[model samples]
Target chain A: MKLVPLADRVVLKQLEAEETTKSGIILTSSAQEKPQEAEIVAVGPGGVIDGKEVKMNVEVGQKVIYSRYAGSEVKLDGKEYIVVRQNDILAIVED
Target chain B: MKLVPLADRVVLKQLEAEETTKSGIILTSSAQEKPQEAEIVAVGPGGVIDGKEVKMNVEVGQKVIYSRYAGSEVKLDGKEYIVVRQNDILAIVED
Candidate 1:
């Protein structure tokens, strides 16, 4: 099931956990920890302002850094998804 | 201690719980229940756009309805505060 955002909303998939431990302590997903990073999957065609359409600044496939506590967590088809506004995106990751 | 947001940020204080029961169940703050409404306390001078300053659309003392899961909760001076972008505000409540 493909997820699509409506009206300036963006869909993000949480990044997979790192294989190595940050402090020599390997952790598993079952630990109930939330990932701080995510990949932008889909974005809505900008929101309307005074009858004008404002395009989104971020693009698909961009790795973004957002506030750890931002956005709503939704489980769709057994997969976790986050829905946040473009403004919630703090910075785009560059590699 | 007053909180002043920076760069289009908005500070909000959660509304206190209703004294009565919602569904014949008395729920307290200790139940870990998150509030769905808040009052806007401070707003940052809007974020820069093309070097132009865009004033915040919302005003102080406005009751805003935000996503139940949006924003980061912060504890400062023993008071709870939420920091969210102006865009995270879904709607304004009218009395």
Candidate 2:
């Protein structure tokens, strides 16, 4: 099933954390305490104000930093996706 | 103590849920399964785009609906607040 975010919400897929911890240890998902990173996959058109539409600034394919506790978890096509508002995005990874 | 969102994020205070439950029972905070509502208390200036600043569409005093799991929990002045981006705000209560 397809999930469409209403307003300026965006759907993101969690990115696998970097392998090899700073201490040179490989951490698996089970060992991680939190998921703080994700990759943008879909975005909604900007919200409407006075009949005018605001456009979203973030685009698909960007890696972003979001609050470790933000967004609703949904399962789409058996994969987990997060639905978050565009503003919840803290920073975009340049690379 | 005050917490400032870095960008277009907003700080919200969770509102007390209605007293009477739909089933005619009083639902206290403990009885509730989720907190899905809040009131806007502080908002950040919109994010920068192409050297121009985007203004936030939300304002203080407006009640809003957000994803049940959106935002980072923080404490200020002994009160708890949730920091979320403006886009995570789904709807504003008219009253």
Best by TM-score: 2
Instruction: Find the candidate with the highest DockQ and give its number.
Output: 2
Looking at candidate 1 chain A, the ten consecutive residues that score lowest on lDDT are A22-31
Give one digit per residue, the lDDT tens place, for model 1 in A27-95: 112122222446898998875743555557778997655554458888988999899877666445444
For each of the candidates, the C-alpha root-mean-square deviation to the true structure, in angstroms, is: 11.5, 12.0
lDDT by residue (B1-95, candidate 1, tens digit) is 34445456677787766512332333233333233567897786665532346678998898887653446554444566666677778788775
Q: Which stretches of candidate 2 lie over 4 Å from their true place?
A: A1-95, B18-35, B49-53
TM-score result, candidate 1:
0.43
Docking class of 2: incorrect
Q: Give the alpha carbon lDDT tens digit for every residue of A7-93 in model 2.
A: 777778877545213324332333423335778987877756323466799988987876544466554334666667787887886
